[model samples]
Target: MKSKKIKIMILVIFIVLLFLSIGFYIHKHHQDISTDNAIIDGKTVVLSPKVQGYIKKINVEDNQKISAGDVIMEIDTTDYQVKVDHAQAALLTAKAAISAAQNNAIKAGITAPANVEVSKKKIDAAQATWEKAYADKQRMQMLINSGACSQEQFDQAVATEGSAKATLEQMQAELDASNAAPVIIAASQDTVEQLKAEEKQAKSDLAEAENNLQNTKIIAPMDGRITKRSVEVGSYVEPGTQLCSLVGLDLWITANFKENQLEGMHPGNKVDISVDAFPNLKLTGIVDSFQAGTGSYFSLFPAENATGNFVKTVQRLPVKITFDPLSPEDALLLGPGMSVIPTVHLNKGDV
Candidate 1:
């Protein structure tokens, strides 16, 4: 009975020691980051046309791989081309008007100087003739006083001097009128400004029309695969309408690890990925970072805990993990929403 009691006590002590050792080792050594289930996170872009038109051609098909700047589709550009032509015609008309206005300004600026020169020459000639006529009148008057000249000759000299003075006055009036700026002629500057404004407007219209025409031919902005193609040839699509969604090659994983499993989680830690779609393919990545809060915190309707009824729930934080570059063959099967299980090794010493 004594030996049996001793053996029983020894067995109970051994079991207690085993439990204590397990608890101590768990506290010191083991670390892991795991998620329930995750999908391959990838970038996607929506293709939208700026112009509304009938689809003329669909150059790409679903799942077609395209490069940057490649023309994926085209719309009937007849209307756009017509607009461009109209803009060009309007530009030509504006240019012609500008040329005519410039010529008018030049003519107006030169007319005043020419008239002033002619008036000056006439004034000089009139002065010379008046001087001669006055000398002749003096001679005739002196001859008449000595009874050597006729009265008619004296009167003729006086009339010639009067005529020269009248001519000078008329020329002066004409010169003043010519030198003064006319309202119609001075308005050429305003006309030029108006034409220039019209020309600028026409150029802008032309640019807009050309841009619209170019937009008719829809081009891919990035290298991606076409998906969710909705439009077909001869189908009418309006602006802001959905044409297709492009899935970009860049991909990452969003692992929602439990709060308890994130003790040693850090960025730059190595990770192993196993995708459900391509189980045979092994993907390697590194821990990018952890989001500040749970994914549900950013939901459209977040949980309102202000009410008196409250329940404590464990929140799962999202950890971003970025994958290394893989070849086309290896990455062909990976896509957005594809299931993946990521396991992060949190042992810094082992890394």
Candidate 2:
């Protein structure tokens, strides 16, 4: 009878302990939200050429690590260099034309005023000569009428007066032409301005040519690894041709958790991550944000639930988790698309 009682008491204690363990596990599971649908994500850049050319050199191989501003490829510059030279020659020609026009303008400016002054002086001299000749003709006419001068002498004096008057009229016309100096100078200035405009156009062309030439060399945009290389040496490529892709070092995690598990989940919640690739390695991060919509909503073909066969389904929302400072070794091992499992601590006070 004693042996039977001892066995029953031991059974009772074991059952009680089993119940307590179950209750504790349930409480811990509720506090921590975990998801296996997670993967590493990061920025990716597609590299393409802006100008068309044959690939002359390639500085990087597939998966080669690089830094920002590193030259990754070179295009044959024969055609682009020729274009630059042609543009430079055109610019020089334009400058020479501008110089010639400016000199002509300067000459016109000085000659205009001087010509007007000289013409005015010539007109004054011709007028004075005409007046003197008129006086001589009048004196000769008087003398001839009083029979002191001969008719031939009077005729000579009259001809002299007529010649002087004609000279005076010619000088007046010359003065009028000289007064047009301003107009001539203005026309010359206009020519200079036109040449200047041409020079500006030539300068713009030269800049464009230089830019094309510079674009022949492809440079890395950021620190990344070369990936998906598609070009080889001597390969002909045009603008918008995809040469390669660069995968950036910046990374984050995308964890898709069920809607029911998001009750206490929020930004700043602590997370413990485990990468499938390195099973033994562990990582820590924080809940950064929640995606606005479920993953299915952003899919190419979303389901239309309003149709005939309507059935409610639980949705999974993507949560962004950012890593804490990673060690160099960890950084090397971690990469985009790697599978990971993350557990979020809903209580902020919990580690």
Candidate 3:
């Protein structure tokens, strides 16, 4: 009977010890963070058109996997091609105009200086003639005063001197007018510059037209799978219209854990993740980073804690978890917005 009593007492003690050990473990490891509020996230691209056009062909079906630069759709390029052709014609016309302007400039450059040189030569010739005629007239005047020449001869010499003087004056005026070579050159250069400016504008227009033509063939910007196809063959699409959503292969997890659970959690901590879609499959990751504020803080309309009496509630911090790059054999089918549960390992010794 004493032995039975001792066994009962020992059993009671063992139960108490077990409870104490469990409580101690709970207190020590309370910083372990776990949350079902997680999702698989990756690069999601919304494909759109830069130029508006009717869809000529849809090269891909829904959820079709494609690589970078793969043709996704072909927009009707007839209008764009016409624009490009018109631009090319305009560019050619501008170039022709430039050539004409250049020729005019060259001709003006030569003509202006040649006119000035010819005017200078004419002034020199006129000066020489005037000087000789005036000398003859003066000699004739002396001859007439001494009665050594006839009146008709003196009158002719005087008329010749006067005509030579008038010719010299006309030549000086011509020289002055033709010496404005700088002004003529400047006017010619201005024409050339105007033509060059027009050429530049034409080139720009041509480039824009070519760019639009290239945009008619829609190509995948990156390797991804297409979803939410909002377009079809023969359907007109406008610029900035949503055509599809592209899901990238590389993905990571976003986990929201309570504030109290952030005590021992840090970047580089290993995480055990389970996808809600595939309960049988398991994944592993490492903590990448934590958001600066709670999820509610970034919501569209955050709670106004300062406006009224506030009830304290546990706040959750968003944490980033990057999965190990999946090998070909272990690549699990996953995508963005998929639900996941993540448990962060709190041991300091692990990588």
Candidate 4:
């Protein structure tokens, strides 16, 4: 009887311990959500040349850390410099042409109206002389018919009147020609305007040439480390040619959690991160945002559920978790594509 009681007591204790363990595990699962489908991600930029030229010099080595605005490489500037010089010369020539045209316009503005007025005055004087001569011819004719004037005198009067009339007509023609002064002025102004347009085009060309010259020097766009250096001292590269790449210092975590697991998840939820490569390192972050779509929805070949027999499948959504300020050493060590495990404390208050 004693042995049976001992065995029964041991059995009851074992059962109680198992139930307590099960209850603790269930409570912990409700409080936290964890997934191993996460990795460190960051910004990456591929460097390319904007202008084509032979590489004259390279100032960066593979995996070299650099800051923004640092010169990474330089292309041959001989051709580009020549282009700039030619553009400058062309602009100067255009400006000279415009100056000459403007001078012609100014001369026309001053001289053309004066010629018109002079021609008008000459026409008025010639009209008066013709009228006087006509009256003299009429008087001579009357006297000659009455035998008071000589025939030679009458003939001289008639010739004088004819000469005066001819002079008046010539003066009228000169006035008509002078009236075209406005047209001449307009033509000169038009030439000035056309030359001015050419000058504007030349200025634009010069600006473009200067821009291309500046592009010859490749500079870092952000604070990063250079990698995949492919160009040598004399490598010929064209526009859009890959010169190298720069990996940015900014880092984040992308955690893919199952659809059912995201029921209580939200942005600003506290998270504990563990890097696979650094087992001893413990990092903290917060949920920044959720991706707009599931991974499969954005995949190259998404499932056509309507066409095939539909089988219910769990989908995963990517959650962006941004780290709290990391130490300088940790920032330098983390990079893109490193595997990580993240546990989100759903019950914990947000940081």
Q: Compose the digit string of candidate 4's lDDT tens values, residues 261-319.
A: 88778888889999999999999999999999999999999988995679989999999
Clashing residue pairs in candidate 1 are none
| Candidate 1 whole-model C-alpha lDDT, 0 to 1 | 0.86
**Native-to-model Cα distance after best TM-score fit, residue 145 in candidate 1, in Å:** 28
TM-score for predicted model 2 compared with the true structure = 0.79
lDDT of 1 by residue, 214-240 (tens): 999888888878999999999899888
Q: Against the true structure, whose lDDT is highest? A: 2
Candidate with better TM-score, 1 vs 4? 4
Winner on lDDT (1 vs 2): 2
Candidates' C-alpha lDDT:
0.86, 0.93, 0.89, 0.93
Instruction: List the candidates ranked by lDDT, beginning with the highest.
Output: 2, 4, 3, 1
Q: What TM-score against the true fold does each predicted structure earn?
A: 0.75, 0.79, 0.77, 0.79
For model 2, residues 211-325, the per-residue Cα lDDT tens digits are 9999999999999888899999999999999999999988899999999889878899999999999999999999999999999999999979998899999999999999998
> What lDDT tens digits, residue by residue, belong to model 3 across residues 217-294?
888888878889998888999999898888887889888888987877888888888889889888888999999999
| Candidate 4: segments with Cα more than 4 A from true spot | 1-30, 122-174, 348-351
Clashes of 2: 0
Better of 1 and 3 by lDDT: 3
Which stretches of candidate 1 lie above 4 Å from their native place?
Answer: 1-27, 116-186, 348-351
